[model samples]
Target: MLRSRVAAAGGCVAALGLAAALAAGAPASATDRTDPNDRYTAEEIHHFLEGFYGNHGPRPWEREHLVSDRLKERIAQTPGYDLLLCAQNEPRDIEVGEVTTAQSARVGWATITTHWSQSPRTAAFTAYVDLDGSRPLQLLDVDCAPGD
Candidate 1:
């Protein structure tokens, strides 16, 4: 459930935004679906990354248009704590931490602690969703380091 929500809000935004910008440059007959879900893929998520610098650096505009404070706040307001407690799939052994979300037009960021997985390794991740809300995917750095 955490993966689903985070992926939807984060990765989907970046992918959708890039899709929109690219779509405008393409011919009108382009067959790609505008829906964000259409672009979502595990592979895309695994390799896709927005650089922090350069011409195509991870600028704010790309992600700003795709996500909203309303959405993030709504997620923050969810009963995530409760879900972690009662959900059988969620490991009950470790103390869970508060959930937080960050947004750019092209991405959403989330970090939380869970006992189900190894320590520190899976504590946080960034989802890069396209502007169209297409199939957003979670991306971890190549070094297995946590993303900003």
Candidate 2:
């Protein structure tokens, strides 16, 4: 009877441990993008921007999906500089700052800080993101500011 009780206790402890592990490993609610109808959370927007700036070389076509058609047209019209990075040369590293929801329910803004290896200066930009319902989150525009 003692052996059976000990075995049962061990199983209970193992089950509790598994449950805790699963909970810890689970993705946050804000990061879940399964439903398109739901408004994009600040965390989601931050994650998207991080992935965008983290990539090397020229921006990929797939990454453009997150940008609106209007913004794409504007980018094409502009020449000599990268509107996204707001610089002629790509930075060695990028740091995406806090994302906050704007006055509009479907809009949010994030600060993107760029660090260059060749220069001591760092640039910052405010990225405007649109979270229209039933559609994937899209970047509307970026407010570029001079480097410090």
Candidate 3:
């Protein structure tokens, strides 16, 4: 009888162990996982823009990897001014505002404010970002704020 009881307890322990292992290996809930289609969240857009504007070394057009083909064409046509900041010269500091989703799920827009150290004036522009699933995030276009 004692041996049978010991065998039963061992069986129970083994079953419990198997259950725990299966539970541990189970996939996370749908909500916990990110959707591949919505990979580029608003926060990601803000970060990308912040990084792009923060680096003043390269011209917006020069960073072909970051700019879309359409934007590159626009830049080529419109010369002299920096299309990204919509300013003639690079700013001392760039403040990228909250990024919001546009009409399309794959597009986002943010207000980029450029501050110059030498002048009290500041320039603001609307930066359109393309969050293409097939490719990395790229700058779609830059529209200067009214009255420069």
TM-score for each model? 0.24, 0.69, 0.67
Candidate 1 vs candidate 2: the TM-score winner is 2
lDDT of 1 by residue, 1-148 (tens): 9999998889889899889988889553212533244333333332333222112222355334333445444435555432212222444233212222222334432233334444543233333333323433323211113545
Tens digits of per-residue lDDT for model 3 on 52-139? 8774524545476788889888878878976766878878878888988753666888888778877888777888887654556788
Which lDDT tens digits does candidate 2 get at residues 1-148? 9999999999999999879978889654533563345677778788877876773322766347767788788889779988877888878888889999753567888888888776787778888888654566677888887434
Clashes of 3: 0
lDDT of 3 at 142: 81
Better of 1 and 2 by lDDT: 2
- Total clashing residue pairs per candidate? 34, 0, 0
With a 3 Å backbone cut-off (N, CA, C), the pairs that clash in candidate 2 are none
Residue 145 of model 1: what lDDT?
A: 38
Pairs in steric clash, model 3: none
